[model samples]
Structure formats: C-alpha cells, structure tokens
Target: MTQPQGALLVGSIAFDDAERTMRTAATELGGLLRRIPDGEVGPRFHWIMFQPDVLGQAEGIERVGEERIPLRMLDARPLRVADGVDPREIRFPELGYARAARESYALFRRLREEGVIAPGMRFQVSLPTPLAVVGAFFPPEQRAAIEPAYREAMSREVEEILAAVPHEDLAVQWDLAVEFQIIEELPGGVAAWWDGAWAGVVERAAWGVDLVPHDVEVGLHLCYGDVAEKHFVEPRDAGNLVRFANAIADAARRVPAWVHLPVPIERDDDAFFSPLADLRLPEETELYLGLVHREDGAEGAQRRIAAAQRVVPRFGVATECGIGRAPAGTTEGILRTHAEVAAPW
Candidate 1:
C-alpha cells in the first residue's frame, strides 16, 4: 500500500509526565516529527484556551460556570467592551512557549544524544490564532479591538522561543481552527470573531506567519475546531480548507513549511480530498492531510491516504487535531497508526 513520505504532529500529545512524554514520542515517532511538542503536559487541556484568559485583564470579566462545565464562558454582556484592558500588555502566562520549548528541547537533546531521537529534528511550537482566542471569549464588538494586542503578545512569545531555541532546530505552527468559521460562514451559530471576507482574513493570517524568521520552519494547522473531541461543524468537503490555505499562501510574505488540513473520520471518499488537486501551494510547502484516526487506526488511515493520493500526489499524515484531549491509553495506538500509514522520515 502507498503511504505519505513523512509525518507531522500538530502539537499536544497525551501524557502527564513531561519527561516520559518526550521519551515516548522521541522513541516511537522520532522519524516522523520534523519537530516535537512538550505533550502539553500542564494546564493546556483545550490547547490554547486557558493561556489567553490571563493575557490581558478585563475589569468586568467573570466566569459563568461555578465548578466544571463542558463549555466555559466569560458572560457575554452586550454593550460591554474590554476597553480598560491594554491590549499591548497582553502576555500569555507562566507556561509560555519560551520556557516550555526550552525545557522540551533540552530533553530532546538528551534523548537524541542517547540515540533515542532521530538527528536534526527541531522543537515544534504550536500557537492559537489571535482570533481564535478573541472570538471564543470576547464580545463581538471588542474582538477587533482586542486582536491587535493579543497578536503582538503572541509574537512576543514566539520571539522568546526563537531566542531560546536554535533557528536550525525550531519549527512553529499556527493553530488555525477558528479561521474555518469564516470559511464555513459559522453555520450553527454566528461567531463573534470574524466579520470580514477571505481577503481581510488572509491579511490577518499573514500577520501571524510573518512574525517567524525565514530560517525557522512555519506551518499552519487549518482545522474545524475540536471541542469535546467534536468539530464545531464537520466539513462537508476540503473546499474551504483549500480556499483559505491558498489565500494565506498568496498573502503571506513567505511560504509556509507546510499546511495541514483535517479529514473527518467519515470523509475517506474522493469528494473530500479532490479539492486538494486545486491547491496552489509552493513546491517546498508540504501538505499534511489529517487522516489518521485513533478509532480505526492504520486501516482507516490507509483508506483516507488512498483517496488523497488521487489528488495530492505527495503529502504527510496527522490527526484532525492534537491528541491532547483524546481518551487516555489511546495515544500510543494513534501515534503508531501515523507511523504505520506513512513512510518513516
């Protein structure tokens, strides 16, 4: 059976012990990762949600849930704005990528020297799009106002990571789940974050990528939102992902190292992948289809890979989103499926 040439991890592997996490991934999937994440070991359960709540201060911000709830909220009060908050001062809290990446990179170095990790792999740092954070918690009217400050803060985190990690050994991925809302027109519920067409979205999207230096690899993880392990809206096809990725490629000053698009588990048909034939990415920019699912493992990945090959002659493999929120004890099987379905790098 044919398989992709390489593989990619879209950040957040599932493990509580940081050292154990690095060792496991480096041992099992070293050949697949061009970069490695810290297993998101701490409080990043939903990836980027918890980090931003502490970035900029909102005077009236209050949590709606008392203890625990599936959906957390900031009590969307209409006519309310984050006006008192200085967006310029927004900074992601303690688990910032700079410190986190450094720690993971040190462990990765040790593992590589011990011959557990593949040589020359960089540390992969994943970040949420500013709009993803703004749209999720901020009021609609304030999202635009709040985005600039938050975007800059994210850049600061990236700058710190670059400063701490070697450029030759670093790769950055922008977690772009919310951008799909604009592409899908936010069918089930109107999202407060996006109000512009594809062009404006592209312009904003370019801002995120441009922050990374040319030498460091930059990639975009285009997603349909993974909340409680379900999409905000399952894609009917890959059309919107293709459209959005092309727009970003044209708009950004530099080409991305790769572009990753999700494949809903049920979408192993030609229709779901045919839009990839229209993808106009630069040759150096790799395409990674998120086709590996924990549910059916290698067999499911193979079916999706077969369908994708008809349109995309070359590509890599990943899950629809990070496996951080996946069921416990399923991580190794999912990791193995990626390696099993794709040719090792």
Candidate 2:
C-alpha cells in the first residue's frame, strides 16, 4: 500500500480553548502537520451556524424567526432586508473572524516561542466563502442583493487578518460547503443566482484565492454539508470534486497551495476514488483526502488510504470535516488516527 504523507486539520477542533487545541495537536500530530487552527471554539464551534446573529446585527438585516431553531444551539434563522431598506446599503460590523484570528495567533505565537508548537508550523485561518454566509443566512431573493455587501465585508476581514498576522506564518483556507449544495442541487439547498452553477462557484473561489497575497499560502476546502455528522448528500464519486478543483487551478491567479476533498466513511472502494485519476493539480499543490473517521480508528483510514493510493499515488489525510462539533471524548482518538495512518512530514 502507498503510505500517506502528512495530515491536515480542517479548521475546528473540539478542545475547550485555542491553547489546549494547539498544545494537544502539537503534542500528538506535530510532525505531520504543516499548519494548525484555533479549534473554532466559542461561537464558531458549529462552523458558520453563528453567522446569522452577526448578520442580524447589521441595520437593515433582521432574523425571520423570533426564537432559535429547534434542536440547534445557535440562532440559525434566515434574515431579511427590512422594509424600505436596501440590502446593498447595509454595513456589517466586524464579522468576528479577524478578531478571533488575531486573538488565536497571540496564543499560537506564545506556544511556538515557548516550544509547545513547532517553529515551522503556519497558523491556519479558515473562512467560509461569502456565498456560504449569504446563502445560509438570507432568503433566495435577498442573496444576490446582499452578497456583494457581505463579500466586501469578508474581503475586509481577510485584509484585517492578513494585516494582523504575518504572511510567512499564516495560511488561509476558503471553506466551500454551500457551493456543493448549489452544485448538487440538493433539495432546499441554495440555488445559484448567477448564470451557470459551475462557473459561478469557480468564479467565487478564484476571487477568494486572489484576496491573499502570493507570498502567503492559501488553500481550498471543498465540502458537502456536515450537519449533525452527515453530508447533505453523499457524492456519487470524486468527479465533481476533480472538475471543480481543476477549474480553480486554472482560474485562480495563484494556484492554491493545497485542496482538500472529503471522503465518506463507507466509501473505501476503488469506484469512489477512481475519478481522482483525472485530477490535474499542479505539482506544487497538495491533495488531502478527508478519510479519517474516529468511529473506525486508524484501521479504517488505512483502508480508504489504500483505495485512494490506487489512483493518486501521493496525498495527505484529514477528517471529512472539522471536529469542533464532535462528541466529547472523541477528539483525542481522532487526532491519534491521523498520526497512525500517515507518515511524518
């Protein structure tokens, strides 16, 4: 079997705080990681679930429902443009990403200086694309009108993060979950307001890649929705992922340093990984397969790794998505699974 190279943490981790997350990751998976994140703790524990509240804070935006959605911890109601208020005129407050990154980087820097983290590891800051936030929080009619404003806000957030953190030690990853919802045309998924779904998605991705300077590393995290540990729809194969990745490689001004694709746990077969044979990422770009599932431990990851190696001879390993929402007591085992299945960098 072809042994996997390194490991990638897809942003969030379930640790109590950024310090613990960094400490634990360094202790267990340090040699295999090129970057580390702040565990997406607090409001970000549920990925973009808390974004509605942030958007609701803007003057012209208000939550559609009075109460939090049932069975969910965060206020995930859709927002609307207030009467007589134009969506394009709304101004968003600090969306919290840059602030969180600034705070986390302080801890990251301290840890590295104190020798808890390796000197070479970059701090990973993952941000959802504007389409993701706008699509998830606003109605279909409001999306197009509000997207530009939100995109501008997000661009500012990126600028803030870049300005605060040293480019040499920072790596930005654009999370592309909702784009898949549109592409798959899943029931109740966000529909693309732009002309062509594929072109629209790729354009947004390229725009995000352009936000970061060439000196800094940027990556793409292509995902299916990971609500309650389930994908909104299981991919038929790696076809869509391969096609989208190739388009981004060609479209972006700078090719992403890495691109990650999720692997459902049940798909440890050649059919699921076969489409990878056509992937056209440049030699400088890295590929990470999210095949590690704590439920099955390292043994199951090996099975998937073996299948993937049949087509793509070299790659990295990661969980299908962030582990911030993972059940208590599972994080450590998951971290260990990555270490056990992949070779050190």
Number of the top TM-score candidate: 2
Which residue pairs of candidate 2 clash?
A: none
Worst 10 residues of 2 by lDDT: 65-74
TM-scores of the models, in the order given: 0.89, 0.98
Off by over 4 Å in 2: 70-73
| Span of ten consecutive residues with least summed lDDT in model 1 | 71-80
Could you tell me how far off, in angstroms, the CA of residue 262 lies in candidate 2 after the best superposition?
0.6
Question: Which candidate has the top score in lDDT?
Answer: 2
Candidate 1 whole-model C-alpha lDDT, 0 to 1 = 0.78
Taking all chains together, the TM-score of candidate 2 against the true structure is: 0.98
For candidate 2, write residues 102-124 as lDDT tens digits.
99999999999999999889999
Displacement of the residue 292 alpha carbon in candidate 2, Å: 0.4
How far off is residue 225 in model 1, in Å?
Answer: 1.5
lDDT tens digits by residue: candidate 1, 20-120: 77788777777777877777767565576565345433444344334433324422222224447564544434436567777877887787798777778
lDDT (C-alpha) at residue 201 in model 1: 68
